[model samples]
Target: MNAGAINETDICESGSQAPAATQFHDDAPAVAWLREAGLRPTRQRVSLAELLFDKGDRHVTAEILHSEVLEAGVGLSLATVYNTLNQFTRAGLLRRIGPTGSRSFFDTNTSVHPHFYLIGEDTLIDVPEPLVLEQMPNALPGHEIARLDIIIHICRKSRDA
Candidate 1:
């Protein structure tokens, strides 16, 4: 082996390749989640929702969601996920994030609160109300105060740190 050869162990420690895909369970509980949210139960809707929320509160873009769907062997088109997200957003089951552009994200937490984006690791964490919002302005002049949102982007130090 060359003295500077790449460390394969650093990439795949198990010494075996990970499966390229996974399949999810499509049973009654998934249906109940949809209905509990007052969303009309449909196979496609339930399947994707189960994938999105089953792992707990997380943010995902349509592309990420679509790829996850494919990884799960759902065999649905990306367009379907996009459309479903739009509908779900309208239905108040999911929140449409990213006013930035195509790089949108779907958040499973519907509650009124803020989020923390770990920019370095590309992860999002829900910041509870007390940590930030508790200190917010209780009253805004001439503003009806429909909602309040705060996004804190974080980054970690590289090896230099």
Candidate 2:
């Protein structure tokens, strides 16, 4: 198979089989972004990247993205979506956030900042203000703090007064 092509033999990180054939669309920005991130610009990857980054920085779960792919008439499995998201995260092209439970949200914005989780809507919103940490606790003898994630859960206030 040529570069940027997705064939049946291309196995996803989840160990699931990929689609038999997928048309590769020429997405210049997505291709350049993937190359700069040191990731191969596969057909599925380019399609998903376009959908993820075309609009703007936002958060999306694998399931949500799978639904979107299906809606866009692209044949991609949920496992593939999960695998691609993880790959993008490892490449520093995306950030993963799991505020609670087993659900994971991939954010296109990789900047260091806090987030507000809308409990009712099950959505995450970036906190505009800069997060200030007065002091950070020392790490263990051999380990150092790699990163910090802060998620503030919010819900609509009850109107029954």
Candidate 3:
């Protein structure tokens, strides 16, 4: 090997490779997730999935994801992000949190649990443990409660930490 030459491992580890073209294939775990979710793992989808899954469970909005994609230099549009997020939600890959003032958050943790929504900061924080409800409200006349979701709104303290 030449003294200043790079190898495949170096290229792969450098984070400079073309993400859409080289990072994931049909056999990749993210790709498998798409397949399980009944989605086609296109290059763009794979790239977005990589970002969403690389970190642990998280709550993100389309706008936030668009910023992230832009920072990563991924050539994607906000509309595309919204579309992908909606598709992921419908396919059960993600859970939609809320439409807080025309903005919705997509939660990677799809399990049933409570969340804390910080009002001032507009952030969503997951509750570490499951919350047990003392009593569930009775379903309306002819309807049944399919699920129960509780969101506690919080505000910043007056004094600084």
How far is 21's C-alpha from truth in model 1 (Å)? 28
Task: Please list the residue runs of candidate 1 whose C-alpha ends up more than 4 Å from where it truly belongs after superposition.
Answer: 1-27, 99-101, 128-130, 134-143, 158-161
lDDT of 1 by residue, 19-121 (tens): 2133334566767776675566677887788798789888888888999999999988999889788767756677655634446777887665567777766
The models' CA-based lDDT, in order, is 0.66, 0.79, 0.74
Candidate 2 per-residue lDDT, tens place, 55-146, comes to 89899999999999999999989998998988888777788889888888999987666899999999998998866666667669986555
Model 2 clash number = 0
lDDT of 3: 0.74
Clashes of 1: 0
The top-ranked prediction according to TM-score is 2
The full ranking of all candidates by lDDT, starting with the best, is 2, 3, 1
Per-residue CA lDDT of model 3 for 30-120, tens digit only, reads: 8988878767787778878988989999999999999999999999999988888877776767878883767688989876667999999
1 against 3, candidate with superior TM-score = 3
* Better structure of 2 and 3 per TM-score: 2
- Model 2: lDDT of residue 103: 85
Off by over 4 Å in 3: 1-25
Ranking by TM-score: 2, 3, 1
Better of 1 and 2 by lDDT: 2
